[model samples]
Target: MAAFSPELTVIYATIRTLDDQHPQATAVLVGGGRVLAVGSREEMAALAPRAHVLDHRDLILTPGLAEAHIHLVAYGFSLAELNLHGARSVSEVQARVAQRTMNTPPGTWLRGGGFLLSELGLDEYPAAAVLDEVSPHHPVLLFSRDLHLGWANSLALRLAGIRPDTPDPVGGRIVRPLGTLLESASELVTRVMPVPSEADFLAAAKAGVEDLAGRGYVSAHTMAFEEPEAPRALQTLAARGDLPLRIWACLPHERLEQARELGLACSPGSLFQWGGVKFFADGALGSRTAWLHGPGFAGGSGTGMPLDSPDLIRERGAEALRLGLTPVTHAIGDRANTEVLEVYEALRPLADEKGIRLRIEHAQHLRPEDIPRFRGLTASVQPIHLQADGPMIRELLPHRVDTSYAFRSLKAAGAVLAFGSDAPVAPPEYRANFAAALTRRDDEGQPIAPAEALTEEEILWAHTRGPALAAGWEDEGIIRPGARAAFTLWDRIGGNARALVL
Candidate 1:
């Protein structure tokens, strides 16, 4: 019998295969799901006469996209819950929940997320009674748009064992007259919920990863928020050789010791790796907790919550570097970014010595002068965030309009711009990222700061090469012979297409 060789698949088209040497390979030879070679259609066909061929003549093929930052498990859960992301007022939120309750069984949890206090047009926290009126029997748990704060109904408060006397946790706050929990305080309620079994965890992780792959994502950086088992669940998938895409996970700062004891360092493996140490510097803009300098927002009374001291961040960040882990901090506001940049500057020499780069997540808003300091750092930002935040940004940070989501300027200042959708906070919508980054327009169709908008090519680079560089994976982002075989097909940017990867 003739030697049985691996079957080949030749993808043909006006190809945009992102291949170097031949950046526009009209045909690709794929074997065992990896691109075996790229050449002219005649050349590829001659080499693999028995190959099965796929003709995507109308599509553009590019490197598989990467979401530089996201919270995967949380996004999976949010997909099953009520979405109040764009509710324009508190009444809108209440009405939606009330309608949802009418269909839901009486005692079931009325779980929901994605309410923005700014979008709700509320000057202060909503009274817990407001949720009580509509959800008297059900325990209502609503996460703020940023996921930093949670608003609960009376039933949920009781369920969480929280009371007026329930003192705030060290790194969180329990609002007075009882309804809201910030930061660590949100965990009080979350901790009471039943832990999902291994099956549930696998199901969620699977759904989330599949959804991303469908959206042209070949890789993601999962920001840790859940228990240690969550990352373990992801590891199980990779270990079993069942994982379809690359996953880089972070360990919360508190778990640093645990990670150390396991002798885990960044870049531990290819499929699943412990890549970064995550820290929260301040809250979110939607919840009005984004730390800022001087007057917080134009008309808002508060300047936003001050969070983990810079000194602490610097100290812990250095330790993470020593352990060969990338230190990534979430900083939403100018003040938050300012402080984090300061911490990074203090530890720059060490980071350089250790060959680790510091990343600042959601560097959404910036002070004019501080923008340049992001130079040589990874600004892991979410362009999809602008769609939901455009209007509110106009109201809150009107004075800093030109500087908010300053993509062009950040790039100009020499920052590596990695774009992502902080799913659960905002769904992982690459089309939306393309639209928002290129247009800088809000949902209302008004330009937030037109000058800040990026070109289509620029947006693509940020979502592709910028993210790969940030993750320290040079070979994966570009389409080269030795690069990992991952590619996304596109009919057009901001349009539908399929993803193909090995």
Candidate 2:
């Protein structure tokens, strides 16, 4: 039975239905927040005589845009915090930190992120003394662009009780000079930061969603990498009917035991829901922490550090699947991808039985031999990284550049290619995502894998349909019966777009 809307609404736009049978429509009649009828304006008007018609015939309409991956609340806090995403030198970083310090009260913790070692022109990790000169009184913690590594001033390090004699924790590293922390090591320091009040978290989430909405995103996949309080903030907003974006959240695999204890199930809510149990297989490319094969980084170090052990991933992945949630692992290097594939292969039968797809968060680099292993899994990638990592990929892992950011290769192998910006690292701007995926070119105008560049239609589908598949959202990413009426109207297929929800 068709669900009649409490209010009949008709939207007249240049509709690209994204549906095979009827690929295009002149207008769409939406009611009850779901697409009712998509057809010619005259036909839809005749079907709904008393419908409220919204005319936007000049713009192009498609499914609501989904960001697919981000640390929502964290991204929000970043908006007001320092931004070092494009700082070209250590001195520049110091200058910015110093400037911020002058404005901030002494002894207060100073936090900021988004710097590339390569961009800073440094081949080695920096030391605390560098930050000491400017931030003598205040404790400081700054993150590398990839967010896998952190640089802390002496005060912050002392606050975390990380002394020179302190041994490195399992699955993490402390740099020789005692200023930098990598992978899990950074977490030890971050855990010391004062916990925000529920109101604080709620405000951050609101800022994050409103920012994305301003960028034309109607929904997002808030990857779980923040404090547990973060998701709670989102849930609170949803419970109060204040969330502006639809959220599909993930749980850190470490919390699976706690989640199971609470009898948490994969049930939908009004605007927020739990989806994937997230795990990090390795660190990121820029941080040089990505687990790679032999001949690691041309002139650099080890076959990047592995984070979550395969044993842990397999055990927790099984638990996540058993709970009817997706097992999402992050893999950025060839070896990382290879290891994750082995784990997924072992869990295939279980996932199949549960009717849930396994997912890999950052299948960035791959061995030609392992490309086909991605079949039947979601390749959740951030194309925006390629813009910055392009030159680095060429310089660090030249041998793999041909296959790096292998979008088309993954798709041809039957892997779902869901696109995102990995925001707080890169801004969640669709234009950047579109440009990077369509051109496969770096900032230097060098094509990383031109052959892997996708068409406008393919990119749109990845940004829309591919994400829907990742989240198991059957009634989104399309304009058809039972699909959400949320739509994004574009000036051109790859041009500026805005969300229009009925």
Candidate 3:
């Protein structure tokens, strides 16, 4: 039978189809937003006689990029918040906060993230007094780069009812003297802070999607770490056909019951859709809260904080699977990985039965034995984080750096490696991801473990095919018949990439 008519033929010099049937295709015939034929320019042109032809004989074409994990709308809002991404000292943070305070009213909530304690050159948490001196009037809540920790000024702390005497919530810590909050403790302040209005969420989501598209991402698995309004904003944009990229969103496990009450499950849509339910298995490495198998962080006292317990994950994971949503867990530390793996092991049969893949977000650190447990599961990781976390990983968990960010090993063990930037933690820059994975180097120029580095092709597959599988999107991240015609044009592999959606 003849391919669909009124097609749009995309001609390129080199096209990496990511399809084994025809690994290389110079042209793709697209109709009705689906790829109708993948072959040579002549073949495609012949297949669609009167089709619109776009010629790019020099650029390389590949499947559209997928951000495996990101806080889509939050990152958008952060674009307007104080960006402390590169501040090297406490004074720098104070200076940024002070400036924002000077510009705004005293009582306004000042929120921002993307600072690291290590970046501040601190052995201990900085006191809130410094921030008080800068902006005593403003309520300030800044988050550590990993978003696992929060740094709140005294005004902000007092507003949240946190005092030196306040007991830490389970799975979270109020760093005493009231300077920082870890894990769920940050929620005390965050919950009390003003929620973003619907308009704000919509604006943020639009900005975030446009930003991702500008960076060449055609789709993202927006790991819903934000409020309900966040995804609603994306849904609104999708409904209006204003969304620039495809979105597969996760619901926080806390809201799983709400989703069930609404009878919501994995409903597929063209632009934005809900796909999985996300749970945090533990905290993050930057905050030293990633539930570890101690003797933990070298000279530290604690192993790490475990967030949602394994039993909780087991229960909700089954519910998510039954509801046709993937059970995605953020397992950072070795212990977290182990516990989540145990939970996944139990849910595997159910996931198989439901034809859904269980996913592990940020499978950052792992034990060698547990690596194989990821077999047939999606290892959703941000390799770009390695550039900054490499030195920290070496200093804190030297014993596990080899297996940390183990993309190759995960893939070798039958795990699908979905690569992302985890923006707001790190920007969604594919070049950063390419460098981090290909070199396995820290920002300090030290190689974490060169042997763990991946090849160019491996990186491409991880960023493309792996994320597609994780989101249960087969038409994306590949160029083949019946696949989405969405694609990315790269100057070269591991170089600049731009979305080329028709």
Candidate 4:
């Protein structure tokens, strides 16, 4: 019996396969959603005379881009929410809230995010009273860009039953003046808000994937910061054949037992799959909750708050590895990184035995000694964050400046560098990442560890292949025979790019 030949398509372009054996190619023969061959245009055309030709000889082709970190559904929903990304002052934020409130009916919950305290020029935590003046009739809840802190109006506080004397929750805090909530405490207000319906989730999931696809991304790793329904929505999209981008998802560590009970594990080879168990060691630097070493922030902020103790990570991480899922920990501050490293060091044997990599998210601040310890680990980092965090790093963590966003150092130490946007916190703009990683410059135009800057090729590899490796997708993030038939067409590398849809 003869094997049937699937319908074929030949793509002619200047291909950068990133495969050492065939680093360059003039054309690719694709069939059944996989690369059939890669070679010169004449060779491919001769091999598949009947194949459909899609010529793009002038553009550069590479493995499709991957957004390594994001909250997919949340980013989708955030598209319609009030954005405060560049709100420069409290007054500016109030104005935006006021405008949204005027359009929304009274008593409706108003939600938005993307403001940084440093960017807002606030020396103290913002008071709820300021919001009351603009939106007293509506309940307003705005999150800092980091998502670690929440600022609410008085009405929102009342709705959440938060008061000046309301004792903080176990792992969170309520700042004075009855307005700001930190960490778990933010959940108090959020818990009372109306939950989105199934329809809402599905729509958000669709919007997210489409947006990413439009931006030339072929895949993304959705972090676990979202509600469970988020992943469910993505799964629905994949099942319905509406998912435009492949998704590698993470489950919150709290759900590890539930996952184990349900017999869930790392099941790949689909548009969506569970790949990681997410644990947070601390909060973000902008939120002043990044657990740090002694003599914390410049203003006596106190060594920042910690979350998800190291013991829990080691225990749950082992369980996750046992199920063949990578253990991904979010570690930002130097102290957080140190603690996570200690935890990873303990789990290294089990991880090695299972042939799974231990991953660290936001390995933003690190001690020089800890850099080498990341060997064979996955540094799932977001270089775009450097644009906003550079000044904050200098002001809040001057001593650890040398290793902040140490892309070069981590790579040198043998860590697979996976770059992402951390979307909804920052836009998943790869060009911005390219600029930040290449120039090592912050929003203030200051150089932050210039020696840590990476080349354009390095950034491209981190954006594509590194993410694929992290997700255990061996056939993705490259252009070669037997690989997924997905590629990005770029006018120039790191410039304008669009997914080469067949």
| Candidate with the greatest lDDT versus the true structure | 4
TM-scores of all predicted structures? 0.93, 0.98, 0.98, 0.98
Higher-lDDT candidate of 3 and 4: 4
Question: Which residue segments of model 4 deviate by more than 4 Å?
Answer: 1-6
Ranking by TM-score: 4, 2, 3, 1
**lDDT per residue as tens, model 4, 273-333:** 9999999999989989999888888878788999999999999999999998999999998
Off by over 4 Å in 2: 1-6
Go through the candidates in order and give the C-alpha RMSD of each one to the true structure.
2.7, 1.6, 1.3, 1.5
lDDT of 3 by residue, 257-299 (tens): 9999999988875688889998998889889888899799988
Counted clashes in each candidate structure: 0, 0, 0, 0
Residue-wise C-alpha lDDT for candidate 2, range 301-345, written one tens digit per residue: 778999899999999999999999999998999999999999999
- Residue pairs of candidate 3 with colliding backbone atoms: none
Question: Pairing residues by index, what is the TM-score of model 1?
Answer: 0.93
Clashing pairs in 1: none
Pairwise lDDT winner, candidates 1 and 2: 2
> Cα lDDT of all candidates, in order?
0.83, 0.90, 0.88, 0.93
For model 1, give the RMSD to the true fold.
Answer: 2.7
